[model samples]
Target: MLKLRKLNAYYGTSHIIHDLDLDVRKGEIFCILGRNGVGKTTLLRSLLGIDTRTRGSIELDGVDISEAPTYKRAQFGIGYVPQGREIVPGLNVLENILLGCNARSDGRRDVPPLVWTLFPFLKEHLTRRGTNLSGGQQQQLAIARALATDPRVLVLDEPTEGIQPNVVADIEKAIVSLNRDHGLTVILVEQKIRFARTAAQRFVILEKGRVAAAGAAAELSNELVRKHMSL
Candidate 1:
């Protein structure tokens, strides 16, 4: 559902991603794996039009969105849960989620039934300040906020980072359910190799701002992991 060709991304003149080309198929969990400082997050930001300097083609469902503004891209069906789960601290849970509805064409603000289904606790704490929640709860809120956009493709950057172990499983299951049961296309930048192997249908290992190894998840062999991802 998403394709990038010869994509290059930069941050204020410091080049990061270099001629990166990738494809994320519909209804599939596409995992991007790499050690720190390898441009994984830059790639996701570039896709969302958050990076100020980018070149080449970014297409979603056959239409080019390379030059679209960030809000326009979101309106075109790209929902982003950024690396830090950047929820507004001052907003209550409900208000934070409602921010995503700005991307919808109808501009409707009602919380979708799916959000409550995925995060039952959020329904009970709609009035609570977003910054008051636990880390995992905050992450769940972030995902719910993104889902509020009704996106065709979800871009998640390190969704499991710093999450509690027990809550991590819940997040993982929700991601799988979103893809398998709901048919949402997922592009996940993940550090947990075990979860990546189990949840992703295909994987790409990034090295020095470009893809070094990529294939069916089963083919992400130990040797490749050691060579490209090991500390």
Candidate 2:
């Protein structure tokens, strides 16, 4: 389980996350929702130790990791898939996935068989350049790469963004499969109401870097959520 308590983070001199708190249990999908620029991505970065948290504690299975560096935190089984699907364009699909292995070389990833089973297209396009794949395929590669690390907790920033509806469905299906099959903890950062509504059990809504509301999906009132979520 991953827990954040009163997390205070700053980007340069500007404080972005304000006393944010959240918890993600194992085998569950925890969704963070809000409009753009509400510091959703920043929160994920903070959890991954990309930014210096000014105060509070981030704990993974009761171990404090707020002060741990990014690489060290990664070594503790935290995998991140950033918003842009940052796969190396010049590298082949296999090589791109290999980048997830925390290795210093190419075609040398110890990728799990289940990962390729989840994303069979990756195996088929192993030699294709990362840039040549379609948007959905690239997204799949990014996710598959993250799984290569064999993380206990996977934090994804907007998995459904910039892809076709069919692809989004596929990604959602994959997330569900990951949780059900491996008990992988998933923290999903999303702006799409439909994605949160359908995929998450609990929801956390941020407005201007603060948690404006939080509750189980069934308890949330749709009309009010839509009001705060309007762009």
Candidate 3:
């Protein structure tokens, strides 16, 4: 339920994303795939209105949010789990997740039940400092924080990157469960081809700030991956 048309993004006149167009259908996992420096993160920043100037239209559920500020975008139901899991250092686990409640329109400040259900460990460690967590726990904390926003669409950048293998599987399972069970629409930027293939219903590969290839996940063949994503 997110659409981008003729979208271009820049960092102080250095254009990063060209006239990229994409549509993320409701309740599906849509992956953005590309090698490094191909504008995947830039596109996400553009969508979030974070540190980037963008042109063209970004429509969410048929309402044009192209000009909306970052907080407004979040209030409009887009939850962002940025790369590096930028959890607040001073905030405790519960406090960090509650930070997302600031974006909620409903005026509720408590953590969403879904967060507790998805991450039971968080409940036991609610008083622990967020940044003191392990890498995998920090990623889960980031995702939990986003979920607390009561989002319709969840956007994640490289959710599994740099995590241990076992924890990677947990995060992957959580992503899939978030979509399959909860009906949350997901827009994911990921480098892992296997997870993208398995978890995404559709995907786009970017090159030089534009879409190089896009289709149903089944159409993402070895040849296409080699041509566009292989190092």
* Best candidate according to lDDT: 3
Candidate 3 lDDT tens digits, 1-231: 899999999999799999988999999999999999999999998999999999999999899999999999999999999999999989999999999999999889998888888889899999999999989999999999999899999999999988988899999999999999989999999999899999999999999999999999999999999999888
lDDT of each: 0.94, 0.85, 0.95
Per-residue error for 130 in candidate 1, Å, reads: 0.4
lDDT of 1 by residue, 82-138 (tens): 988998979999999999999987788888899999999999999999999999999
What digit string (tens of lDDT, one per residue) describes model 2 on residues 1-231? 888899988899888899888888777889988888888999999888885556799999999988888877777888899999998969998888877888212334587798788999889889999989888888999998888877888999998889988888889899988987778989999877776877788988888999998888775578757777876
The residue pairs that clash in candidate 2, if any, are none
> Comparing candidate 1 with candidate 3, which one achieves the higher lDDT?
3
TM-score of each: 0.98, 0.94, 0.99
Worst 10 residues of 1 by lDDT: 44-53
The Cα RMSD of model 1 versus the native structure comes to 0.7
Model 1, position 140, has a per-residue lDDT of 98
